[model samples]
Target: MEIARPQTDARPSPVRGPTPGAVLALLKPITWFPPMWAYVCGAVAAGAPIGERWYLVALGILLAGPLICGTSQAVNDWFDRHVDAINEPDRVIPSGRMPGSWGLYIAIAMSGISAAVALLLGPWVFTAALFGLAFAWAYSAPPFRFKQNGWVGNGLVGFSYETLPWLTAAVAVLGHPPSWTMAGIALLYGLGAHGILTLNDFKSIRGDREMGIRSLPARYGAGMAALIACAVIALAQAGVIVMLHMAGLDGHAILIEALVAAQLLLMVWFLRDPVSRAVLYSAAGVGLYVTGMMVAAFGLRGLAMPV
Candidate 1:
């Protein structure tokens, strides 16, 4: 009797080993820092006009924005195991430190806690939290796989990351949803996030291409992708200046615009290369500029309109 030989299959060995700090890194806890500042600015913008409680708004930022974002990141890492295996083998699950299911449970639990906080704020905040959770889920899940949906994916993640936090802060203080000024801040931040996401795609171009992912860098070459990143940052900066001027927040605008221009120039130079270090620096720089601008705007506005 002739037996068919077992088919020969060749693939890289599955990555193994537990990283003790896997869960910490898996959450990308650092990413939530900038969003917290963004929400604080939103709170300032909301309460500045009529003078409202800012501390509660800040608390909302901590509980709703960063907490939820961290949880969502864990969920993202869990669902993205295959992609991570190819794009970032040393990551938490791919590296074998934490189990994928555990990550999912952690994300779910955190999301629940965050939603409870949102409910304490009000109905609008609760609605925003729900939307954010949905976006986070779809970002890496199979049905409506935003990560593979190109620009659509980027927009989903970007909007949730930047917009919802600001809206939540505004709602926490203003007792309602986003106002025109709040919307402007969201738009500006969202654009910057879009650039960051696109730039990140450049680092994973090869893996994305091999995995049939439709990321910006895979669809467009790295050079063009970086150029797009620069353009997005420019537009985001321009939006901030325009919004500040339109809102008649002139005193705040001057300082914010100057800082933004400096940051923009840095981004332009950084985007000229797809080097890993450049990308990392660019991400950090964006975070710094946003935080600094928020501080300058809120600080000056508060002083200028002293009660």
Candidate 2:
């Protein structure tokens, strides 16, 4: 069955400025949590005293979440307006709530603000934010438009959301690159995030097929895509669990093992009815996934502290 797409007007509206609620909707505050949480995990894993310069920590969280992440959301929504007419018509741009090319304007302005804030945090953080902003534009805009291909697109978003902010915060606290061990852990979690992101593809298969978006579900079919997504997530976290055990953090490894096991059970349910249950699995599974991230961060922090 063909999904009905809402009628959309591509012409910019004449409204001078959209209301603040529209702007907020464009920025998508709900999408901010992942990167923010990753930043905090990095800070904790760095094991540096934070109370003295707590404000810097706070700033890093802002850069990771509301600034950089929010900017990405705006950029995505603007470029995705057409696809969203079918997948999510109520979105700011597609719904005409953000008038007069305001979505693009906000993305550009937020990119600048994110850069300015990142520069304040220091060069490494600034560099990370630059890469994030670059990915944001490329993932959505012309010339690159990585979102056309699920593999490249999901990889970029996962890394930007998980790996980049993580290292940025770690360097902010450690005043340099993190130890390879910490970097490796962050990489693993970011890789797992790819699968988490793929879960989002299931929601838009009809629209993506019509729009040539080639999301996992659109490309590979729901059951196969669900299996692949679960595999990617499981393998990535399996690597983390092994790394933790090798570091003698047996208890933390055990906790993540339990989390993964629980997630596996949830995956079973999601796989049985992938289209309707995708969001449900994401809610339950991602909670456990991020919990494991924090648990591993604590393990790293414990390793950093001396007896």
Candidate 3:
């Protein structure tokens, strides 16, 4: 809801239509990389020649990052505007760059545009987009607002960002459901991403507690939240490693193990000072994590290598 402010002078207010930059800021493009990367991984893991349906790959990436993911960011920023006023007053909405309910309007418009694009992709991608948009709204809007709880919110976002894009891309390129191996790997990576998203909560722990948002750090204290994050991430990564080995991708499995070993060292530091080191781990640890995702994808391609 837009709040009314009292006039103190006859001068005009800066409130007006949002500029293109403000709209972009509201959409938060920096947050789009994860889903885009996941989409590529999915396409790769499908073992189809990328050059054959390169257009589908391009469209899927666009849908994952700019269209679908961008709408989700807009929705989240709109709903979190009040909270941002407390923790990040300079964000577009709170900063008055996006004035007078423009954020909500932009979100709605983007959702419609995203739908049209997804429809062009095909039935599999379209269905995933519907569920993706639904969860995007449900994660932020009233009566649901899954973002209020760390467990539910993290799981929703993790799956929506990682698994949804990954699986959708696989089907978009392959024109059918992916194999169980591909699906299971996507699930494992998505679960690990839950821990990654949880790390984002540490920055606003105080505001989250003050505003009744039940982020893991605010709900269970930062130290415990860090431990839980590490455990979830490590366990998910371990699952991928075991599955890779079982699939006879021993070389890839060893590489992922080395990556996880590196992340474990960073996790130790993150646990020591979670509030301060969460971002550090997110950058360093998550780099290795996503690296494993691509490695796993490439390894799956080996399954179809020449006999």
Candidate 4:
């Protein structure tokens, strides 16, 4: 017997094309902060004088946040409209706010726009953008829809949102590969963001399960998943602190340790009711996590500066 799929409304396209406002809503501007902030951290970590390269910096930020990240959001929404119909019926695509295949069209259009903007940034930035854009599409669309598996999906998102943008910003600013220290920090932080992505899955557990999406919260019970997320985040951060100490960035290590401590405390509170508190933990705990990232960036900058 064949497995049943979730039934989605077959809505017709609007007589008119998507409005500008509907297209903007499809981009999900609120989801842009993490990548943009990561790009800024990378720029700081590059230890380059930005006095002459302000235009490049600005363009890199735009690419990271609005173009690349926004494109991902649009693609995910377009491909996941059926799931969103159950999880968030009010969403623009599912609710017919944009209607029919317009969501898909918008995503495809944005992908081209992102590539054009990336090429203007630099070859390194353009290469990173292509990788990010590829992951964005693979995460949501086609036979390789990575979102079906929780770990793979979350890991891809973490790397795309954090490490890729960080590398792009560093290359844009310094016109070379970032130092090993900066690269290492970006990798760790990107890995740690797996937990953040897991937390986001909490909000869609019901829809994910019903639609046969194997998100962590849907496959493993929310409580167990919460514990796993806490462990992943805490351990990765512990590794970062150790690496910082080994590098003799004592002040930065201490600051990051304090931030991690605070995140652990918040995690305890979040675990008390994981499903209900996922958003709160994401906003509060993840905020501290990114702040620590910025601190580490500043420390790397000091080390990268000329003696």
Whole-model Cα lDDT of every candidate shown, in order: 0.71, 0.93, 0.93, 0.91
Q: Over the full model, what C-alpha lDDT does candidate 2 score relative to the true structure?
A: 0.93
Cα error of candidate 4 at position 137, Å:
0.1
Tens digit of per-residue lDDT, candidate 3, span 1-307: 9999997888887657999999999888889999999999999888888897999999999999998899999999999999999999999999999999999998999899989999999888989999999999999999999999999999999999999999999898888998898899899999999999999999999899998999999999999999999999999999999999999999999999999999999998889899988888899998999999999999987774455
* lDDT assessment of candidate 1: 0.71
lDDT of 3: 0.93
Q: So what's the TM-score on candidate 1? A: 0.82
Among all windows of 10 consecutive residues in model 1, the one with the lowest summed lDDT is: 296-305
* TM-score (all chains, Cα) for each model: 0.82, 0.94, 0.94, 0.94
**Which of candidates 1 and 3 reaches a greater TM-score?**
3
Runs of candidate 2 with Cα error greater than 4 angstroms are: 1-14
How much is the lDDT of residue 125 in candidate 3? 90
- Compare candidates 2 and 4 on lDDT and give the better one: 2
Candidate 1 steric clashes = 2
Model 1 lDDT per residue over 1-307, tens place: 9999998768877754336477678778677875676677667656545345645776677764567788778878888788788988998878767863777777788888888877776787788778888888888877877888568888787777776676677667766665666576676777677877776676677788887888887988777777776787767767776777777767666776777777766776676666555466566667656764575447434543548
Per-residue lDDT over 1-307 for candidate 4, one digit per residue giving the tens place of the 0 to 100 score: 9999999889985587777888889998989999999999998889999889988888888988999898999999999999999999999998888977988888898899999998998789889999999999999998999999999999999998888888789889999998777788899899999988999999999999999999999999999999999998998889889889988999999999999999999999999999999998999999999999999999988888898
Q: Model 2 over residues 30-63: C-alpha lDDT tens digits?
A: 9999999999999999888889879879999999
